[model samples]
Target: MKKNTLFVFALFIFYFSFCLTTVAQTRSREDYEKLGHVVWEVDTKEKIVAITFDDGPHPVFTPQILYILAKYNAKATFFVAGNKVKRFPSVLERIAKEGHEIANHTYNHIINRNITSSTLHSELEQTDEIIQSIIGYKPTLYRPVGGMHNDLIINTAVKNGKLVILWSWHLDAEDWKNPAASQISRHITKGIRPGNIVLLHDWIGTEYSRTSQTVKGLETTLRFLYQNGYECVTVSELLFRSEIIDQDYFNTFPIE
Candidate 1:
């Protein structure tokens, strides 16, 4: 009886230690991201990356992007705004029909910093409804405007069964700034690597500069990625993860 009791106590201690380790890693491990609040990038060595656009369904730029993507046979993820999707459901349908991923970018591209729970949920649901109405389903990825998020946004989004996403700060093309096309292309193509998620824009924003520059940058960026044999995939495909194990430090999840 004494020996059996000792064995049971040992097993309990091992289990307790394991749990503690897991909890610690979850809180403090920048090395591992198994998808909760946000997945900035994926933990993989594959020579693939995701090219994502946000805040759009632009009548002009979206079609141009689609043509470019089709030319390369590349699949991209688009985080579309609800109002814009409502305005251009046919474009969203074309995006889906072309085998691109249509994700949620909220209703109006509002900042996620102090929005109420009800507002957040409403935005998400309304956007989702618009997307579903067009594409027959909604995407699981949720990216807030400007890559901003707080606990409220994360928790609310997770509760709604969606994963929050961000992109590499360095990989952002800054197309929204209406920079020169060559500058945007050079900024992205410099030192590109596997598992990088590049944030771009397809929104026209009432100016030809934004649309024209983004399209030009995209054409150059795609050519660069193609010449180097890099496959531009969807964000969900880039983040193809497996179960976490003992000791591995993947350069994903760049959260502070």
Candidate 2:
């Protein structure tokens, strides 16, 4: 009888914890917007969007992505890893030279949950130093590794003078999974809204072909946006261009 009772109690505890996690993950974007440091997407009516790339500065893919951006006359934000920056300093310089924004993606791309506060600070500091060395200034924006964060991460990042940047919930192209270029392009273009922050990856591991697909997919999406009279700008541009009033309620909430 006691064994059965303990099993039932265990199940109840598991179910209760699941419910709490669900609630935490489902908080509205407005709730986050009010926090001043978390910005997933800006509220605006202009025909512009922020196309951001992460895990990049690859010797080959970075230049390809840069050429495409130059061809379309679009600016983007590159959230590059510090370790990659050390290996490809020139590529990082080119990203800065091209008038794109360079944000920090941590030193080793360690996710927030896996690291302690001290480790997180070290990651940010090391990345900041490398980026500053290459770009002549430190980055003000920081995207948590894997888009995962907690109160400790957020508070620590704020203390370090970084704003936590994330992508629009509907705008992730999921190009890392090596989807068809057409599908990836269509997904981004369809979800393109004013002030939308689109997420893409330039260096997706050693899978050379996968990153190539992202390049191809981005080309198609850029062509569509260029021809459709949409200006693709960096994340900072999107934020500044928008007249976001603190009291205004954003219609959609991005997943936490």
For every model in order, what is the number of clashing pairs? 0, 0
As for candidate 1, its clashing pairs are: none
What is candidate 1's CA lDDT for residue 122? 90
Error of 2 at 229 (Å): 1.0
Instruction: For candidate 1, write residues 1-256 as lDDT tens digits.
Output: 9999999999999999986664312232243243445677665677788899999888888999999999998999999999988887788889999999989999978884767778888999999988888777877789988876665666677766677778887888777888999999999999578888889999957625334798988889899999999898987767663222212323223333
Query: In model 2, what lDDT does residue 134 have?
Result: 74
Local lDDT at 73 for model 1: 85
Q: After superposition, how far is residue 25 of candidate 1 from its true place, in Å?
A: 19
Every model: Cα RMSD to truth: 12.4, 5.7
lDDT for 200 in candidate 2 is 91
Which one is best on TM-score? Answer: 2
* Model 1 CA deviation exceeding 4 Å by range: 1-35, 207-211, 241-256
What TM-score does model 2 achieve against the real structure?
Answer: 0.83
